[model samples]
Target: MIEKEGFAALVLRLRAEGVTDLDLLTAFEQTPRTQFVPPQFASDAYSSRTIPIDCGSFMEGADLAAKILSKLQVRPGHRVLEIGTGSGFTAAVIGRIAERVLSLERYRTLVTAAQIRMDALGLRNIIIRQMDGSSGLHGEGTFDRILVTAAFSAMPRFYADQLVSGGSMVAPLILEDERCMMVRLTKTGSRFEREDLFPVPYLPLASHIAQHL
Candidate 1:
């Protein structure tokens, strides 16, 4: 288990690494990562290393997560759409920063567990659902920001279309050379402006909904 002092130290370390957003930092600091991981991996909660979650998914490391949040620049009034809920730790953190968060997970087991964790933390603004996130909630209205936790071989047009003009999406994109890197796409009048953020190794975003966990 990471002691209180250890967690604080971790936050401080993130701060040193350029995660300077106050609200983003606070959201991460308050949302206990230990609660999102399995009991066997509790000790690795605050480390800068990926950990496994249910349905063969992996939760982003705390440091990388903080960086993603920083790049997101979520405002208090922004509505965020998270493509993969995974353990729901990122959604939980975003729930504290954004006005609302609609997190999509393909597996029912993950949806149930993530919802339970959200409810336990009193995060009423976050809604976790079991759906193929690759499609980007069709009937649902637009979003101010979209965070895709999985890497995409190419930028999905549907996701860019779902964002309101001037809104942005931060996702792991597969480069031409087959290297995966984080990229931010800002929608502007039916067009998107892309910016590269950082390199990352992530599983491809699945398009098919799982029938079984």
Candidate 2:
């Protein structure tokens, strides 16, 4: 858990970095990063660096996570679909803003732990499942917003089909130049608009689900 002073300082730093959204900042303050990381990395919870978690996956730094969520612009009435539940920290934060969050993880261990954290925080609107997100969540109906924590080598067209009209999806994609950059795709009826945000070092999205942790 972050002390009051620590959270205040973190919020101030985020504001300085341009994450001034009031609701987003409140979500960040309410969701403790320490609860989503391993015990050994608890002290590094508030740091601007990724930390290893169970199932060999890594949680993105708090600052980067905040920036991505801010760009996604999740509203209180939007239903969010999160690909990669990681430490459940991101989903918990989204839960504070979105109407509902469905987070998918490939590892069962990660899914179980994420669910426990969400329940402990009294975030019942967030649902976590162990499933391969390579193709996105088809047949699961449409979503108002989608956030993918992993990098995709190419545009995930399948996910685009699952988005509602005018919905937006934020994710990291590998450009032709071999640089992984954060990109956002907004659906406008039958077309999707692309917007490159920033560069990020994110793990590639696994094609297959893990059979074991």
Candidate 3:
């Protein structure tokens, strides 16, 4: 658990950095990064840097997480589909704002670890599953919001296909030239509208759930 004064300072810094979404900030306060990060990186959990996790995965910083989740425009009754449950931190944050969240991760270890943390945090609205997230979760049905954590060489049509009409999605779309940018997509009557957000650096979406990166 983060100390009260220390957590207050972190929240103040987030505000100064222009993380203006009140609900996201509240989620940040509710789920301390320390509780979701590896023990070695606990001290630097609040830093604006990505930290490494097991199986060669990395976890996003609080500000970036806040930005993407805020972009999703989640509502209290919205069901979310998260493509990566790297640290379970993002899913946890979304769980606080959305009605329910189905988070899919490639690595079994990560899935197990995330589930443990979610249980510890008492976040009952989020479900962590070990599955190849690139394919999306058809068995679980569609969702009102979808978030893709990894960058892809092309827009992943599969995920877009899984979104309910009028639903929103935010992901980092990597181009054939290897450049990457965040994109906000909305499903609309058999078609999906795309909006390119700002540029960001993220690893390519894995083709399959590998034992190691």
Residues 1-213, candidate 1: write the lDDT tens digits: 384665787778887887778788778878988999998988888888899888899988888888888999999999999999999999999999899999999999999999999989999999988888887897789999999988889877667678998999999999899999999999988888999999998998888779989
Give candidate 3 regions above 4 Å deviation.
1-18, 211-213
Could you tell me the TM-score of candidate 2? 0.96
- Alpha carbon lDDT of each predicted model: 0.89, 0.89, 0.83
TM-scores, each model vs. reference? 0.96, 0.96, 0.91
In the range 1-213, model 2's lDDT, one tens digit per residue, is 354666776777788898999999899888888888888887778778789988889988888888999999999999999999988999999999999999999999999999889889999999998899878888779999999988999887777689999999999999999899999999987778999999999888897789988
Backbone clash pairs for candidate 3 read none
| Candidate 1 regions with alpha-carbon error over 4 angstroms | 1-3
